[model samples]
Target chain A: MGKNNVEQMILNIPSDLKYLGAVDAAIQDLAREFSFSPDAINDVSTALVEACSNAIEHGNHFAKDKRVVVTLRFNGGDFVATVQDEGRGFDFAKALRDEAGPDPMSERGRGILIMRAFTDDLKFKCDDKGLTVELTKLRGGGGDAGQ
Target chain B: MKITQREVGSAAILDLNGKLTGGPDADAFRDVFKSLLEQNKKHIIVNLEKVSWINSTGLGILIHNYNTVRGAGGDMVVMHASERIESILYVTKLNLLFKSFNSEDEAVRSFTAAR
Candidate 1:
């Protein structure tokens, strides 16, 4: 189906971990509506968490006043979700580069990698306002991730 | 995520359930691990059989705890990881960093075996 023939949902939550449950609940509902495979649903769930975590922890810097916006669209066959933050964006590319050599002892720097692994298509955008991370996965695109 | 603790011989087994995504959930996991370190209970095995999933934040928590225990002359490993969680570890290359076992008994045995 065409991207225009899509149903969209927008949710905005404060940049707080306590609000994560609301976001995840909506995701579960969307997955069921989209008839996503169990595995696909799990992947989307994990990826969504990572995106929101990065937005709150890195993009918004845990600023309670800031908000994270999540947009979900189902184009009949594919589901796309976008996470938007209200703080200045960092160089995601640079972060990916730094995380290239996984350090067993390192305690951080794997958020983006995990996001990329569970989604079929992942994109990052930044502007003066903040950053946006988009994640997409097909209904059957449930197995063999990590890019 | 909910984390419960138990002891098997000299090893500490942390039973995890639900999603290990960070936020308040992550804080709980971190607190438990920190307390274990404080108690000098370092030979740890995180049992993930009931853990439905884990994100990057969860992986970070695991790594952080692993290093902490190792630094204290102890060790940490994972057991009963779901297929999806195992895939995450492989993609992130954490599989190379931490020892993984198919069962809690196997993981517990590794610590003594290493000694």
Candidate 2:
């Protein structure tokens, strides 16, 4: 695929966890269209789901009136997804700087770590409107298919 | 998610199907653990062979249930986790905390073998 052949898809949903399946489906389809390896597709799908979950839970606080917007962009072999939530975001830098990380037994606080692990690149931007987390993964970057 | 409970020897196995992500699924899973504890069934095995998807929230639910079971002097282990689910567990290092198995026989035998 050529870089010029860019495809973009957008999804806007309420801050409900129920809609996560739709996001996963969309990412899977787009990754397949880009000819991403199965492992890469799974990586993208998993990372994006974590991003959206954070947007819905932490950013939007699951407020009924709040909304989460997801934008997927495919360019050549790169798949990029941005999750935006209408709420004040947390300190991404501070969270990452905590070398001790979260308690091994803790139930929460692993979402960000999972998102960072499965994606090639993860970026965050907080503005007056809300916080947007951008995740990027490259086709064939999933390494060994067996894993 | 759907959870079906059955007893094999002294272990109570929860066969889970569908996504374990948070929401109603989390509540249902919690309730199942609660019921198990009330029944004095402490040894638990979570069979994830049919579960298609799991996110951080789902992991949270599992951790919460694991802690609850452990606190009740019980134990929880998982079996048949997909590569995707395993990836999440590995990333979060929960793999170290939760013992995993590849087969039902091995998982079921673990409870007996532990003693």
Residues B1-115, model 1: lDDT tens digits: 7788999998999998777767677678778878988998889999999987676777888887777788889999999988778878887888888899997788988989998
Instruction: Tell me the tens digit of each residue's lDDT in model 2 across B17-85.
Output: 988888788889999999999999999999999998888889999999999999999899999999989
- Per-residue lDDT of A1-147 in model 2, one digit per residue for the tens? 455488899999999988998999998987887778788888999999889988898888889999999999998768889999998988998876763548978888887788878887888999999999998887645522233
Judge candidate 1 at residue A103 and give its lDDT: 69
Kindly report which residue stretches of model 2 are placed more than 4 angstroms away from their true locations once superposed.
Answer: A1-4, A140-147
DockQ of each: 0.55, 0.62
Q: Candidate 2 docking: what grade? A: medium
The TM-scores of all predictions, comma-separated, are: 0.86, 0.94
Model 1: DockQ against the native? 0.55
Residue pairs with backbone atoms closer than 3 Å in model 2 (clashes):
none
